[model samples]
Target chain A: MQHTISVLVKNEAGALSRMTNLFSARGYNIESLTVSTTLDTKYARATIVVTHCDDSVIEQILKQLHKLIPVIKVCDLTPENSTTLELVFIKVDSKNEVGELLKIAEAFGVKVIDVSPKTYTLQAVCNEKQLKSLVELLRPIGIKDIVRSGAVSINVKSE
Target chain B: MTNKIITKELTGSQVFLECLKNEGVDTIFGYPGGVILGIYEAFYHEKKIKHYLVRHEQAAIHAAEGYARVTGKCGVAIVTSGPGATNTITGIANAYLDGHPLVVFTGQVSASLIGNDAFQEADIVGITRSCSKHNYLVKDIKDLARVIKEAFYIANTGKKGPVVIDLAKNVLDAKIEFEYPKEVDLEGYNPTYKGNPKQISKALQLLCNAKRPAIISGGGVLSSEASEELTELAKLLNVPVATTLMGIGTYPMNDQMALGMLGMHGNYWANYAISNCDVLFSIGTRFNDRITGPSKEFAKNAQIIHIDIDPCSISKNVTANIPIVGDAKIVLQAMLEEFKAKNYEINKENKREWFEQIEEWKKQRVIPEIQSEKLHVHTVLEQIYEYTKEYEPIVATEVGQHQMWTAQAFNFTKPRKLLTSGGLGTMGFGFPAAMGACLADKNRLVLNIAGDGSIQMNIQELATCVEYNLPVKVMIMNNGYLGMVRQWQEKLFDRHYSETKISGPDFVKVAEAYGAKGIRIKKKEEIIPALKEAIEYQGPVFLDFIVEPFEMVYPWVLAGTPIDKVILSRKE
Candidate 1:
């Protein structure tokens, strides 16, 4: 199972390493992670997508994170309770299939960021599922390079 | 008086001592070196805090641990950077796992020279990150006081552990206006001291309903000073109390309900009760691999109620049917009140069968009593215990066969009476820990039961003991081999000793060279007299007893085996 955890941590020196050390020490897999300053300068938010952990492991992960002195808050985000987005840039080789690539990009609501004779770099902002589908559709056309901004999450209130 | 206003300027070194004074620290275990010269300079004229200079950087921390355990105050130590800082890692890791509170200051290279690989520089904070509760590198003079304050608070609070403060050379030399903070507000760390009322009520319900009840107390019982509460609860419920290695002395071993200790080397009846009990309520013990033979099989017939201060420890190794996350002292007190308020009757008849079963297990296959004429460590330990029992002496032990023998042989009757490295199993920890224990209380007879092999690790500390006249008796069990490893090799590794066999310098000569008395008991008849002489003598004494080489710790529970499936003797 996978869990996207958002951690608000104290913005202090060695805080980032301390937060990451917990995952490394436990041999937990960090599938993807993004860290940035929160609104308050004294703290920072880390959005991490972890793999291969169950409910018990998640509970342990949260508790362990809370144990670290620099960590301020930990939130285990599920798709239902939170809004998440991942930005991925896919550079296709084109291979004389420019029309097909553009069609595929448009269907996923992706933008044609760059174009060249040899490649077309398309940027997609969507959930993990749509990103996976977009990559699968472009794989046959040939992906020259790919880069992704891991999950960025925010909690949503229930009405 | 209150901490005065921050108007007076003080050197960083002065600020350091003042902060310690504010925290009620009067003693420090430390070693002076190149990087820590500034602090030493400040100490030259200081009279309030006395520093005990240990021979090795390692002993300094270990001694602090000894001091901390007996006194229940966070131990303090200071060491120079690079090798000095690195040497304390073992002690730091040892305290971290055993749940002892310590505040260790490591002198670092100047702030400008950091990462440039300056002389005597080491990235101690990064090195000790995993091993310590939390660590700090003070780059600025202003953060020094608060860092020290936070270090003490963090070390002494929650689960209680060692916190390292890597004091940069410049930070120590720089000037600042010192004002120690009265409170530390850490956002991430808030230990649950008061358990959830509903969960605790449910636990009480389980206790009230349990006919075959047993309690497994861990080091937390002593850490939270809840032995009184634990003892009361056990008496009220007519429950037997089995303790983990670190939990020894938390419950008096002589008590009828006391199960001594439960683990791989635990007593037979205790492990049997763990396997068969209907309700196994445990307090303050992390169910480490040693405590649980096979997690799935452990307490299989029981509904377990676990009380722990660390939330992560609950359901970590074994699932808890009712988990109350809180300090053992407070939670157990609450449970006692709830039980009393409800007026739950002690069902003595329902528990009669359980007690009878335990008694049968105890009589069936007791810990083996060898009738051999050859000198055994057990005999020497028994004599020492017999002599010191009336005094309520403190016993510390280094890891290995002797440590287990001490655990088996002694009847510890109070909390913090048995101080050993239970969690990390670090060898060479006992002797220095004894020095600290002695320093903490001059009234108690502090003894370090050591192995011939393990004592050599920090033998240089004899000089420190001699200089301070700490009167720490080091009783070495000389087996001419690392007995525990030899026992395992004989059984599991096909009689190959490997590197287990060892011999060293004459301990009598070593003691004489360090200006301490030394006695050797080579024959079986000499054990009692030598113990009497060592205990009665004034200064430090090293009593070396040559014991049988092949003796093993019985009631050996193999990994993945059920707790009840223990080998009673060597042949089994």
Candidate 2:
């Protein structure tokens, strides 16, 4: 099972490295991680989406995270009526592949954001699985560049 | 919101010293280095706190552990950055494993060059996080006082362990307002204090109904200073008491109700009693794998009741029928009160036969064999005990057969007199620990009994004793091998001694090189004379006794084997 956990932590140097090291040390597979500064100057929020772990194992990982000095709060937003998003940017061949890419992007509710002489940039805001499939489809059509903002999640209601 | 009287500006070192004074620290063990020069300068003029310059940072930490173990007080240690900090890792881990209260301070590179990999810049906090109960990397001068206070409080409180405070060099030099925090406001640091009343009542009821009840006390009781309450409860219930290695000093070893240590290398009688008891109450011990050998068959006839300060330890190793999470002192007091309320009667018939059986086992199995002219480990231990019997000296030992022999032969009638690295089984813990123990109670004699192999691990501590003019008598049982490991191989591995053979420089010469009195005892009759001469010396003394090899610690219960199947002695 996959778990998407959101953590609020103090913005300090080596904080990210410590979290990543913890996951590596425990042999936990982190499929996706996205971190950003919150509106508060003192705090940074990290949304981590991990896969192939049981609920109990995830709970123990969360408990260990809670023990970290900088971590203030941790919440598992999965199975809790939450909203999740993943943004992906891809540049495809505009000369010949633009029409086919646009058709596929339209099918997946993606938007064409930018165009160049030889390439076109496609923007996608969708679930992780959909984003992955869309990227795979655009890869064979001459993908010049690709960037992905790993999954971010929030619960439907207040904590 | 309120005006306050401004104090004079002070250097970081002065502020650090003031914080320690405010925390009521009387002594600290440390070695000065380039990074910690500021702290050293402050120490030169500090009159309130006495600082002992240990030979090595590693020894400093172990000495601190020794102080904590004997006094139930928070021991403090200071070391410089990089190598000095790294040297203290083993001692820190040992204290953490043994749950000793210790506060360690390490100097760091200047704040400006912290991340630039400057000279002597090791991330002490990052390296020690897993080993310490808590740790802090102080970057700002203003946070020093609160961090120091919190470090002491955390290290000395519930399930006590070592805490490290890594101070940046620039922070030590920066000026700041000094104000110690009266109380900590940590959100996730609450430790459970009161055991569940319902569980306590249930445990009491179980004890009331048990026909053969026993209490297995561990170091937790000693850490909590609950020995008095534990003895009262045991006597009120007429229960037999057994101690783990760490709990040796918690109860009077000579008490008839005491079954001695119980574990892989424990007394046969104690192991048998634990295996045969109807109800077993374990307090302040995490049932280590060595103690519960083959958990499936451990205490097969008993219902276990485990009481520990940490809730996670309850079911981590052995499953407990009744688990009580609280401070050992508080829980034991409540149990004593409940026992008083119930007016519990002693199960005289059950205890009578059990005690008789233990005595029988002791007479047949506990006695060591006198084979030939060669001096045995037990004989050496007996000689030491005989010599120190009148003075009631403090005995600290390194791990192995020598330690067990001392524990078995020496009659410790009082608490805090027998100090050893029990939980950590740390080698080289004896010499420095003995030194620290002597510092704590200077009026009494301090004896360090150690195996030759174990002694070599931290033998450098002899310099510390010599420097301080501490008269610590060290007896090294020299068998030219790792005696304990060889014994195990002989018993369990078809007598295949692989890497047990040990060869090294003359220990006496090594002691002499370190400017300490040295003596060697080869003849059987020279043991007492050598010990007396060494004891009479005004400074630290080392006695190396080249005892017989292949002399195994007997009445040994082979690992995974039952207590009843113990091998008493060699047939030859």
Candidate 3:
């Protein structure tokens, strides 16, 4: 099972290390983690995606995270109850399928952010499913490079 | 516009002592080094806080832990950087796991030199983060006083544990206007001390409905000063009471409802009650594997109601039907209030049946017997218990079989009387902790019951005890092996022994060299007189009792087995 946990921490040196230590120290598998300063510059929010964990373990990890002095809040986000987004940049060899790739990007409402003689770089920001589909659709076009911003979420019920 | 501003100036080291005073700290256990020289200089000028210079930084922390455990007050320790800071790691981990309140101040390299790997410098904050309840590395001089205040507050409140504050050398040298924060507002650290009304009601309902109820009180009860409440509740509800090793003194051992201890090497009756109970009321215990045996099988027939101060500990191991996150004393009081409000009373006849069953289990329980004419370990503990029974002495122990023997044989009738490494089970905790206990109260006798292997772990602390003139009587059960590990190897590993076989310097000679009284007893007949002599005239006395080398703690439950599946005797 996978869980997307949102953590709010004080903006300080080693704050991220303290939060990540809670996972690494316990051998919890963290699939993706994205951290950025919140609107309040004094605080930062980190969205951590963990895989291959059970409900009990996830619950404990949340509790341990709460114990960290730098951490202010921890929210376990679910797909139904929370809004989430992941942004990805995909570069495909467009010499062979320039028309096909552009058409596919237009269909998904993605922009061709960059284009070279042999490749086209497309940018998309959406839910994980739509992002995965875009990557799958472009695989036949020969992906030259792909980079993703890890999942970030906010609970619908709380600020 | 003539406006005059007043500023008070003081060095960071002076602020350190001032903040400690504000926290009501009267004593500190610490060792001085190059990086901590500034604090030592400030200490010389400020004589308000008495400092006990321990021989080793580790002993300083253990002594502080002992002091904290005895007084229910936060213990304070100070050590210099690098090796000095790392030396306290075991003691910090022990206190952290056992929920002892300790605040440790470690000197660090100047801020500029921290990352340069400067001489005698180590990242104390980074090193201690995982072991500490909370830690701070004070970079700015202005944050020094507030961080110290927060360290003490966090260390002593809620689910108490050790907190480390790493002070850079430059910060100690820098002068700042010191204003101690009256209160700390940590957004993430608010702890709920009161039980939820609904949860209390539910727990009370379970208690009223239970036909076979058992209360397992743990270290939380001791730490929270809830023994009276726990005892009253158990008696009021006609529930049999058992204690974890850490909870030894939480209830009177002589009480009819009391079952001495529960878990691996716990009393047979207590283990039986746990396995058969209709409702298991656990207070202040983490349900560690040693107590639960096999987590899945533990109290499978019972509804377990776990009340802990730390929310994370509630269901980390075993699931709790009713999880109450609150201080043990507060929660127990709430439950008692709810019971009275609802006019709930125990059905005497129904409870009588349960008591009778526990009695039956007690009758069938195996009490280890000394089959040899030679002196045995239990006999030594029994004699010590008999000698010290009148004084109600504070007992501390190093980890191993002697610790278990002391737990089994010694009578701890009140809370905070017994101090041992219950969680981390760190070796060499007993002697220094006993010194700390003695330091806290000079009137009461302090005893350190140690194994040959464990006593040697921090034997250097004997000098500290002698220097402080603390009357800590150390009784070493000379088993010549790490008795607990050897017992396991004997049972499961074909008795290969391996590195379990260990030797120690003659403790009597060692004590004499440290300018402490020394006594050696090789026969059972000499035990009582030696104990009396040592207890009567002792700055510090190290008594070596050479007992049976192969004695094992019985009623042993193998790892991952149910608590009920205890091996009754060696033959069994």
Predicted structure with the largest DockQ when compared to the true one: 1
Note the DockQ of each predicted structure.
0.76, 0.16, 0.75
Clashing pairs in 2: none
Provide candidate 3's TM-score on chain A. 0.95
Superposed model 3: Cα runs more than 4 Å off: A157-159, B1-8
- Each model's RMSD to truth, in Å? 2.2, 4.2, 1.5
Score residue A91 of candidate 3 by CA lDDT: 86
Error of 3 at B278 (Å): 0.9
lDDT tens digits, residue span B280-343, model 1: 9999999998989879889998999999999889988898999988999999899888888876
Runs off by more than 4 Å, candidate 1: B1-7, B365-373
Per-model CA lDDT versus the true structure? 0.90, 0.84, 0.90
Candidate 1 lDDT for residue B89: 98
lDDT of model 1, residue B468:
86
Can you give the TM-score per candidate against the true fold? Answer: 0.98, 0.86, 0.98
Indicate whether candidate 1 or candidate 2 has the larger DockQ.
Answer: 1
- Using lDDT as the yardstick, the better of models 1 and 2 is 1
Kindly give the stretch of ten consecutive residues in candidate 1 chain B with the minimal lDDT sum.
B364-373
